[model samples]
Target: MSHLAIIPLLLPLFTGIFLLLLREQRIYIKRTISGLSSIALIAVSTQLLCAVSDGNILVYSLSNWPAPFGIVLMADRLAALMVLTTSLLALFSLIYAMSGTDRQGRQFHILFQLQLFGLNGAFLTADLFNLFVFFEVLLLASYSLLLHGGGRKRIRSGLHFVVINVVGSSLFLFAVGILYGILGTLNMADLAVKVAHVSPENIGLVKTAGLLLFVVFALKAALLPLYLWLPTAYSQTSAPAAALFAIMTKVGAYSILRVYSLIFGNEAGPLANLLDGWLLGMALTTIIIGSFGLLGSKRLRQQVAYLVVISAGTLLTGFSLNSQAGIAAGLYYLPHTTFATAALFLLADLIVQRRDQMEDKLEAGLVITKQKFLGVMFFVLAIIASGLPPLSGFLGKFMLLRAALEHPALPYIMAIVLVNGLLTVIAMARTGALFFFAAHAVDTATNTYIKQSEPEPLKVRELLPILSLLGLCVLMTLWAGPINSYSLETANQLLDTPAYIDAVLGKEAQ
Candidate 1:
């Protein structure tokens, strides 16, 4: 289709570089540039939904180089949806962050924009090597951003994130090299074609490499056992930082989903079949573990971290179905989980900060009034996070559970997920009990800062960002049709490798 498809990637890339060139004292200009760039990015991503919704995959090759030599960027229904979700989240997060930050001044915005560039590039790039490049671009920026405020705690977590990713990046490189050496191409489309020709023995080796590579994804997605890094990092970072990060793990999940379908598909080459077979078991265990974590935890921030595991489990369960309906449900649930899980974490962060401020003030014998509006904001976010009906989170789970029940194996799995959901409801109830229902709200309510008497409980600035995000959640819930339909269609596209294979490699040899 049109080359405009690449704007999602280009806009952020140049904007980030431009910001880097600013003088040492242009924080306002930096914020302005970032804000405008973000608005432009959002606008571009939305226009794409309308442009590509009519059943066409937009492909733009970089430079004048043809398919195999130059990098290719594609805008399919799936990719556009992801880009749109990421852009909106980034925009809201930037808004929230701008209100309060002790960052690298303007550099903070630069890195944030850089991070967006990488995310957009990852979603749009058609080449496997290119995908790897984009993943690093984002990951490195994230590493820097995570430690932006310069705390020993955040730095500690940032190091873990960096070291682990370095390992994953190494593994990914090895996997790509193996794939290209075997398949003679690094283009995802090219590999999709040449994959079948590698003998059964070779396919086994390839699958081994694939699984190795997938482990990297699993680690990034914070799948069970591999999920230790998230809670600490999210907890230590700023609300906006945590909020933006909420979307990062999903990128890993998205990559794994694509790789699983593209290379192995239904034919299920050696190692791929095994992963295909065991995904349900892994998902089930992840859900059980995550729910139990939430159940055992009293802290709201910790509970939200556990919820990340819950979403991963849910997405994995959908992928495990391995059927059209199952895949469709997984695809449909991706954005819903992306929004709900991350937003909940953000809301939790905000609540905890307010509570901490009050506690500090009370210790100094200052009386403070709790803001009614902030309480209401937390209440609304809590309900949505719990997957209650009239919320998109509920509809996502509903679709997935329905899909799971249709499969014989999935019926039992769905039951477990149901239990998981109940546990989630309980964890959310605990948050409400702790924050709203307890004697604490009444006995310890305070708008005053411990150190300063004039501090307000809930400033309008703090309340509006979250409210706007919550509004988006409502819109998604109310209009699940458009999003759901596109997800289902994209799922169809994901399951069938031939169309994608043909796109990159042209027709296969007879």
Candidate 2:
């Protein structure tokens, strides 16, 4: 019954409602409210992380009914960790949004809060139906945010985003409905209970439902074939919007993590044996397709978008491995990707802003010729994106590779890893050289920012958010040890479902 369990969702929900009233008021007031709300969320998430780090599952029942009939919010180590990441990223994006003024401020902040609420709810929820409810809330806000400013590019891409997700939601609902029919419950923990006695043959129903549900999650996570909507939808939107979308896909990954490990693992289920064959095959195919897309793409934005496909594939690889080590690597890498990719996209937004200033023709090489600081940040991000050595990105890849090296076809597996690594490096290197070389060659961009370099040159406030995000990238690389250890714990908890089930229920069997 701790109040801390729900603050992540509540703060954003309250801020969103309040922001609606301030729609026509002063921007400062709206900014103040948004900033305050984000700060509040960060405080609460931090408190929960501290409180729950000792491996406690904080469960809250909605309206106090009980298991099968009641709605519940469950916060374990993994959920709390995700809440912390979501809160931090949201705070940075909100602060960035507030510092830069625009016509979209009110609408932007409102949708932003709504998105947080959706994410928090998804992470915290214990019921299957409730997860879908939160999913819709998250995507609905995303649709509006993507379409903000009503640009033609945004409009087309937003429609694609909307149509694809709508179909996903429909599929999610069908899965939920079928599960309810079979088990007579929508609560995840309760399903885990009733599933043990549900006759071996009827388990076919559960496995089928699992496949259908995986499709929906994969669509949202942007796995191969189903991920076509992500690139244009992402590239067409503004930086702030892209920052938020990056975290959103992680929610889908989280759902996949939860479902595979809990329902289909070695926890009294017929589906346990089937996970390797179906899931592993899908993961391998996703990697093959995603790596090809990464190799073929030339633009910075498109390259990153394809990498999301690759990350999704990585997630599936960990899932398909079906071992604690596999789960550990997947869990560790998932959040690392969330933070790294979010920061990278924010960096790219800054690059695009600067590049946009050049108007494609380069204005006689004046606009982009001499911005040294921007060049450094761009290269740093490129390295992070490529998953080269000594970065958090590399840590995840290394663990996955280590775990996979034991297979019979170890050489082929290593080659796949090698090829993917090379492709990422080459693609990122090419993008970096284009800008860094240009920056060094151009004498100066001082005169280009304005007709003349004034005494107090105007600050690029638009870049502050991007820099703040990039700063996080450096912090993650520096603090990789602590982060990876915690993620390891998260992965351990994910693979060992007994601890999770017990934490949610009573120790003495009530």
Candidate 3:
């Protein structure tokens, strides 16, 4: 069972290599292979999640070597859940791409699989250097994916995105080097143990390395000042690619949680709470900026991009509280926001495609195809995005707010969250009314022009992916209780440093 830790990483790795070997124009074959691999990943990840749900940590050491000296893959509740989420998103996004977007570029399937490979490796790796390696793998794939349906706008945004991430990768290397030099170990579990015993004089170096590491993760998570690159990059990418990118930010948040809780957590004498104040302040500022961006966005994809920023802010806000309850709330909120944002991005694409020349500009134009159905879908998604009643978003936000009340930053965080929610509602309402309700020119039966119009219905392929994602949101709402319970359990597991160390390095280490 412990060997199962490597399956998620390997599934995508081999699938990507196989995809690379296929003929470029063999769309059907590529789609079939990608779909099957995604399904298999979902199955494997679900099993892993179930296996680890009981507080078990499955660690696979490479070549029969021991921890702190050998490469290892570790899966607990948190990692398994992240893998499941990534697989779910990958499946639907691949389906959406098959609808037509895959034709926009060569090697779409290959890049998509490689992206998953990177994501799974990042989630499962127990070594810091391997984590950096996985980051590069994912970043490299993303650079190509961002330019998939090449356009001038995409090129510009992709250039900036690539430059920023490359710099971030450099910083990651520097941080890893500092840790390896000081601690003589890069395995996360070993680092956790070693960090607790660092001499007072050397503590400053460790803290410096930790802070630099936080900066890299922060850039990935799109925290406040570091988030400027995200909106344009996300908005300009192809929709399916954007939907997959939805999980990228969560990867950053996951890294922070995993690294901080294991290495610099409560057990790490002087390193504890080093990021609390900075994280809280940045999270609040991110929410404010995202809200303003939402209100100001002129394009549909751009608005959705800001919504991603808002989701990041909400997750980080919960995490910055640094309490078990707060962290659990963040974990619960993550999937809800991820699914909802992905759905919105796909919906934006559907609307844009149907509008012909109008695109997704949020202006009065040609009547959208499948107007009635899309109208309802957009309405439901709007409610979800705005954190309105009877959806997972509302419940997630409620949990975060409830948890925040106990924190000293409650006033600021709560007020900003509420205000941000209101702004989101306003922005979404404005967009919905423009796209669904605004009057458009129409041709009558007698061939005369009129000011009223109706839209064409959507194809099943395009509709399926959007509806599937929305369905997940509904399922998440219905299953919030068990899900939240699982989140709490996962959070407890993360905060329990001794158990993780002992699981990886054995009882003697603890």
Candidate 4:
């Protein structure tokens, strides 16, 4: 059972190395290998999740060394669940890319595999320094993937994304250095124990380091004031890449949950509740900004990108409450948002491909082929993204809102969330009307401007991935009871930081 902890990290690392040796022309071989590896990852992550579901924490130490001294990987329910979610998203994204998008670059397969490797590593590692290492690995892969199709807009957005992250990475290193210098340890479990015992005089420095780390994570999570890069960058990227990048923001949310719950949590004395006011205020503002962005977006992809921001704000709002119920709701909301957002990205690309010359613009154009099928898909996704009833989105938001009622800031958070949902519905409805109904104007245009041709029908290969993602959202709605149960249990485990520490560092640490 302990050995299984390393398989998630190793699977992608070895596959990525193997892919580097293959030539660019061997597209079929590359696709086969990538697909099989992704399936294997899904299996491995599921097994790990089941193993940890019994409220057990599995730890694997490298080279026979242990605790605050050597590298370690820890898998608890939250980590395993996150890994499984990531694998599922990766598999579908890879399938979507194989429909001719992978040809835009020479080493798409290799970069994709490396991205998985980094994400898995970041989730599994129990050391802060190694977390930084994995972050860089993933960012490097994403930078290349962002510019894969090589358009001027993509390149320009990619450059901004890269520069901002580079600065974030530098801050990450500085924070880690400060902590290591003061505490003489980088292992999370050890740091948790050491931070509790820090002298009062030096505690200020510890708080500063912890807050700096939060800033770094906030940049990744696209928290307000640091989220300007996401809209342009995500809107301009290839569909498959944008779908996969959905999980990247969750990585930051996961980090915030882990670090705050374990290290600077109630056990840290002065550091406890350090993030409450700031995180909550910023989160509500983020929701408003995202909602306004969605309403003002002029392109289909850009609207979806803003939806991503809205999801982030919702998740962070739940997390900021810093209670078990709130965290559980956030956990339940995480996977639902991930699948829905990814599906929208793929669906947008399909819609764009079917248009004659308008190409995803929010204005009238030639009628799309497969109009009924696409209309149904768009409506279903809109409901899911906008938190309408009969879908998981509504259920998740209900949980969050119900949990928020117990907090002191209930009125503020609840009002913002409700308004955001209303704005989202309006934006989605207007966009759908423009895409499906406004095409009637084409018949009235002058003869010189007339351009008529039957749009291409949707392909099975392209449609499969979108349908799979939507099906997942429906499944989530059907199984909400069990999923929420697991999320609640996961939250219980996270709040009980002492058990996590003891599991990783033995009984003496507790």
Please write out the lDDT profile of model 2 over residues 1-510, one tens digit for every residue. 886888888899999999998888887888789888888898999999988887777888779866657888888888998898898888776665564633564588888889999999999998899999999998899999888777888899998899889999898988898889988988887776666557776778777887888888878877766878987888777767776777877787788888777766677555664456566656666667777876776566767777777777777777667666676777777766776667666666656556654422212333344567766776776666677877767777788878776766456556766677788888777666665564432346353333422122225555666676667666767877787677677777777777766766555431
Per-residue alpha-carbon lDDT of candidate 3 for residues 218-251, written as tens digits (9 for 90 to 100): 9999988999999999999999999999999998
TM-score to true structure, per model = 0.92, 0.91, 0.97, 0.98
lDDT of 4 by residue, 1-510 (tens): 269999999998889888888855579999999999999999999999999999999999998698879999999999999999999999999999999999988789889999999999999999999999999998999999999879999999999999999999999999999999999999999988889888888788888999999999988988898889999999999999999999998988889889988988888666776687788888889899999999999999999999988898899999998888899999999999999999999999989887857888998777573468988999999999999998999999999999998789999988999999999999999999988877753455563455567667777868898999999999999999999999999999998988999999999876
The C-alpha lDDT values of all candidates are 0.75, 0.74, 0.91, 0.91
Q: Which residue pairs collide in model 1, if any?
A: 361-450, 368-446, 368-447, 369-446, 369-447
What candidate 2 gets wrong by more than 4 Å, as runs, is 99-102, 357-367, 408-412, 438-463, 507-510
Alpha carbon lDDT at 381, candidate 2: 66
In model 2, what is the error at residue 428, expressed in angstroms?
1.4
Off by over 4 Å in 4: 441-451
Better of 1 and 3 by lDDT: 3
The per-residue C-alpha lDDT of model 4 at residue 146 equals: 93
Best of the candidates, TM-score: 4
How displaced is residue 265 in candidate 3, in Å? 0.6
